[model samples]
Target: MPAGSFTMGDSSGDRNRADGETPRHQVALSAFEIDATTVTNDDFARFVEATGCITEAESFGFSAVFHLAIDAPPEDVMGPATGTPWWSGVKGADWRHPGGRFTDLEGRGDHPVVHVSWNDAQAYCEWAGRRLPTEAEWEYAARGGIDGAKYPWGDQEVDEGGWRANIFQGEFPRRNTGEDGFPTTAPVRTFAPNGYGLWQSVGNVWEWCEDRFHPATYRRGTTAEKRTTVTDPVGPADGQARVMRGGSYLCHDSYCNRYRNSARSQNTPDSSMGNAGFRTVSRRGAER
Candidate 1:
């Protein structure tokens, strides 16, 4: 994507107000090229086959999976995970077996690889000779050159044009009607590309960004004199949770409506889940 300036954060003030989606600020970024799609199972498989790298999920012997999508045995499904009753920690859940031990990459090789932590994404980037897009770069690229737009494709509601992206439909947690033609994850390139030729930058799977996360990261310059135009901001210098952009397949309007371009979420670098994945970027031009 070409370098440009855009006002970052929730201009609509419609979603994730308290989750650091406010204080829409002007941000300028340099030219960079991002992967058109999130890293797919097929792409990650090649990396593993060449390096024999073991993902954190595989090393831990378990990963988080949505309750409704858990295909593991009753014993392997270790109930819900505290406050998030919708998510459960399942044994033998990894990228290869997304649903659980019983599941495999039968027809889902083209889908975004899940059960990948930020560290795992970094490892993949290292192996592929690329890097995760910084939070600023991500938002800039996600906007597709459309400043202040709620989504990659414009401010029209996600479902306003007949299932623009893959996200939870019908009910949340309890049931998904698959009104978007996907109950869980859709293919990496299932939707139309943004103006910059980027695909699924809003919904599908949460793409990890290369920045430490903090709810107050945006507030640093909110005070008057310091509130000048930030050029290529890199988020907080230190934090336990890394940034995750692009809401996942489980996102829904009734609950987690964070699938917008300015929406932000975070998780520990070692944490892995079925709803998360990442794409890579080339900062020094489009070499990849």
Candidate 2:
């Protein structure tokens, strides 16, 4: 990606005010190299094999999986997560076994690796000599040079162009018709590339960024401080949760409609879920 500036948050009325996707501001970013696709199960498997790194999900003995995607036996299902009835904690859910003990990464090696936490993503980045893109960079790149657009492909509805991205098509939490050709996650490179040649920038799985989560980060006098363009802005200095962008395949307009370029979400550094994954970026402009 080349050095450029863009409006950071949601200005288009379609934002979730509670998620703090407001008070849109200007952000300037430097040239950086971001992966064209999110890290796949095969990609993470290589990292794990090379470094012998155990992900938080594996160490914790449980990870969150969508209710419909859980393939574990009744005994292995740890029950639904608090507040989110649609998500259940499974005993053996990890990147290698996305659903549970009954599921394996047999033919889904090309799909984005889920059940990864911010810390786990960091480990992979360290081993690969790369880093997660900052929230600003992620949004800028996600826009694919089309600033202020609702999505990476610009304001046409997600389903307007023949299921542009992978996301829940039917009713959420109860049924997914797979009208988008995927109910859980599609291949990392399943969608068309954006102007920058980046695929699946918004829908597929939420991609983690190198930023601490703060609802008011866009507020004046908060992080950026000034109203003018802030060059290479990172994020808040400290927070309990890390930022995650690009809503997952579970996103739907009837419910969690956060699949836009400016939508934001967060989770603890060690919390892993089946709908979250990440891509890496090289800070060095000369590196690819």
Candidate 3:
């Protein structure tokens, strides 16, 4: 992609826009190339085999697994998150064993690798000689040349015809109708690509970006101040969490309607969960 500009935040008029998404601003980015798909278990496995790297979740001894996906005994499963009880911190859960020891990536090698943290993603990027996309680059590529569209496909009517992306189709937490043909992570290429040939740009799994968390990064000049473009912008210089975009399978319109192209959220750099994964990008002049 060539250098270009686009709106980079949720619109104030959008009822679904959160307070953090305010002050929608223009962002200018340099040319870059991002993965058309999230990194898959097959992709990560090659990295691990080459580098002998262990993901943070594997080292920390746990990763957040959706309660509905847990197959182990209740006593063996780690407790749920403080506020979101639907997320269970399953022991032995990692990228290879997403639902804990009971689960494996047997026939699902093509699915997006979950249970990965920002640190883990960086490690893989380092090993693969690629890097995570910045939040701006991510949203820019996600928009697929469209301006401020709600989704990669520009269709707000989710699952109207059929499954466009992997996400909760029925009641969340308690039940997943699997109308999207998946209850957990679907194959990386399950959905049609965006205008830019990017698949699952709005859902399937939350993708980590190379940016620190800051709700106000896009807050900028008004009529009183000169307009400026945030050229090839990076995120906050310091923060406790890193940015995650494109929502996840667990997201639903009833709760987290964050599957929109402009939607974003954050997690600690070391935090890993079954619903999160990432892709890689290369600078325009860099080797892939």
Candidate 4:
């Protein structure tokens, strides 16, 4: 367990944006243990073999596939491909089958599992004697140690003398040079761990947290000058979509840069796509 306080949100940097991560504020948290890495295919496979869990995407018979992977076929692929032609809704594209029919987790056992919805993640957590981290807990862990720093390692744009983290390294949508050494999700723990010894907290895949999305929730405060500092902030009690954090390999500066520690995004609890996956967290006293 690592204990520390940090000024949550962007800390005034070139990548910092206004709208969501505004009015950066200080937050303190007690020591807690987070997963060392995102849940990998091997990890999920173990859980499935032990508990016989079937993911929601698999039950639905279809899941979101990246445009590039979807379009790689010989043009005879059969499925309800997205009209956008970029994001194809391919059948059998669940966690086991990532890029539709042809793709499999065979050689990529260490890769983070995808196509997991909030409910699916919760189920896994429950089975593992753990739970999804709240948005506050997630952000606190992702912030590592540097107070208010933009990226996980610090305010520095690049990894220590190297391009760290898996993100789009070239033009978005059209071309990706794979300068980050990966086009899609890299193996879990491919990058260095944060101060808390947590890995892949900033990129790889967006993680689901225990919170609901509300644009106005950020503004609710005791007074106009200061917003209420919540203890173990659980976000709004009820809402349509749940919060997702840490962004994913799909994140790009030209499009979505939500991989930043303080950034927040959301999707329906029932919705599971290729870019979304999750990790589990357990309380200190909980049986492990």
Worst 10 residues of 4 by lDDT: 71-80
Candidate 4, 176-249: lDDT as tens digits:
78888888889987878888788889878999987787655555412355544544456777679888999888
Model 3: residues with Cα > 4 Å off, grouped in runs: 12-19, 220-226, 283-288
Model 3, CA-based lDDT: 0.83
| Candidate 1 residue runs with Cα over 4 Å from true position | 222-227, 283-288
lDDT of 3 by residue, 84-177 (tens): 9998888888999998888899998999999999999999987877899988899999988888777887755667786788888788778898
Return the lDDT, model 1, position 193: 89
For model 3, the run of ten residues with the poorest summed lDDT: 220-229
For candidate 1, write residues 177-277 as lDDT tens digits.
99889999999888688999898998899999988888888887455644568887777777899999999889988999899999999999999999999
lDDT of 1: 0.89
Model 3 TM: 0.94
lDDT of 2 by residue, 130-226 (tens): 9999988899999998988999989999888588898888888899999988888899989699999899998899999998888888783235455
Model 4 alpha-carbon miss at residue 265, Å: 0.7
RMSD of 2: 2.4
